[model samples]
Each structure stands twice: as C-alpha cells, then as structure tokens.
Target: MARNDGYEDLGAWSEFGTVSGMVAARTTESLTEAHTGLGDRPDDLDGLPDVTVGVSAAEAIGDLAAELSPPPPKGYDNEVDADGDGTLDDATYRGRADGGVDILVDVDGDGRTDFIGADTDLDNRVDHADYDKDGDGVFEKRMFDDDGDGFLDRSVFLNPGS
Candidate 1:
C-alpha cells in the first residue's frame, strides 16, 4: 500500500459537487487531522443548496448557518492587548488550513489594525508585512524579514507597483 500524501482545496465547481473534495486517507486519524474542519463540529448541512427556494433566500439561510457555527480549532494561538483595556486588540493566526501564519496588530487599541505580518513558510517568523503608520487605515509601507529571525530587516515605501 502507498502512504497518503495530504489534501488541499481543489477550487470551486467540480464533478464532486459544491462543498466537496477528495480525501486520500486510509485511517480516521488522518482524515480528522487534514485541515478540512471536519473535526471541529458536526454540520447539519443546512447550508446545502435548496433548489426549491430562490437564490437570495437560500443564501440568507446559509449565511445564518455560518454565523451560528463555531470557529475552527487552532485558529488563533496568540493574542495581544495593545492598550491594556482588558480587550484583545490584536491576534496571530497560525493557519493550519492555509499552512501559514499571520499576525495582525492594532497598536493603540483603537479597533483599527495598523500592522500585519505574514509567515509564508509556517516557521513562526514573519517573512513580510504591511504597516499602517499614523493610525490610518491605509498601509503606507512594507517590511521584510530576510533571515526569518522575527526581526524585520528591510523596509520599502509603497508606490503603486513597487
């Protein structure tokens, strides 16, 4: 027998139907650990497409179902309170499904994210990030961590393409 490799999103619209994908695992443990959110909770399939209803109504019900569902496991492992107001102002998402980590920070607890860092290699270190200085919503510049040392070593101003 051959060892199973892993699974990834195959994109929308396939012969398998919507909300469907291939799972190439022989054991239940492998299927549960695959980042498909199967281990999170049991979904009643209320979001499935209903041909009897109009598209807008079906969409509304699906949105409601999504809102009522619980979040996935290991979604956010790290959190920070920037202003000491007893509320989490920032969070770091160690993505198991996307296979990367993203750190979002709101420096002053003003409810606006001022900085974002991305770890593309899943090494717990940011490779690049966009920064919003002066509390504005627009990201003014970008920084890069060339050595994966958790310290941004390079900076560049954003100007359209560069």
Candidate 2:
C-alpha cells in the first residue's frame, strides 16, 4: 500500500511493513493451527473479533514489533587472520542500539573470547578494543574513545593475571 518514486525513497522506507505483515500472517496461521483442537462452538464466537479485523490488528502490532527490533550483528571477513595461520577463527557480533557494533573473536578456537572490537559511534570504524593478549582468558588491554569521537584516544593495561 506504499509507493516510492526512486531508489532513495525505497531505501528510506525499506520493507519492514511488508515483512511484519508476513510475519503476523504466519504467526496467525500457526496459532490457528495450534488451537484447532478446540472444537468449533457458537459460544466461543462471542469472545473473538472477526477474522479480517483480527488479522489487520495483528499486522499493525507486528509492524510496531519490527520497528522496535534491533539490527542484526555483523561478522568479520576472512581478511582478518590474526594468528597468521591462514585460517579464519570464529567470532560473534552484537549490535548497539544507540550506534555501531561489537565483535568478539575466539582467536584460539577454545570457545572463549580473546578479543573484542567495537565501533561505538556507528562510523564503520573501530573506536575501542579489549584484548586478551596473553591468551589466558582474561582481558589485559582496553582502548577507549574519550570524546565520543570515532577514534581510540586512550589505552589502559590490566594485570596479566587479572
């Protein structure tokens, strides 16, 4: 039901509304299927709205839910071979609501985090990092952005065993 004249307009509007509607429709279908075991009866009709209105309201609520959802996290490319072993290690991504992303890498493949890279300003730049340089499962170095700028302005070193 929405119209767009150009790519920019389309990009600005995105597909959240349509996606939400689809999600709601699927959800409704699943719920209906799950509840079908309850035999049809005239008395049950009084408590529920008409199907069309219920679907419309569900879609509107889905749209609101989609708007409130957070962006998906991003992963690092294969270019970052930190250990120089010519193989990529595993990593996880978390998105910040205000801005940017946080990446946690398991450099040794031991199922523990070894490094964290963050872009707190959403500028596609690394503004902070915490590293477990000794690979002992404890972070020993912290980099920070002091002025809210997309740049690391200070570094603090923690005890090796801490």
lDDT of 1 by residue, 6-103 (tens): 54555454435532433433444466445555467665679875455534553465346546544434534545443336786546343434566556
> What TM-score against the true fold does each predicted structure earn?
0.43, 0.39
Please list the residue runs of candidate 2 whose C-alpha ends up more than 4 Å from where it truly belongs after superposition: 1-90, 144-154, 159-162
The Cα local distance difference test for each model comes to 0.60, 0.62
Q: Could you tell me the lDDT of residue 89 within candidate 2?
A: 49
Model 2, range 116-140, lDDT digits (tens) per residue? 7776655655677787777765678
Candidate with maximal lDDT: 2
Look at candidate 1 and give me any clashing residue pairs: none
Best candidate, TM-score-wise? 1
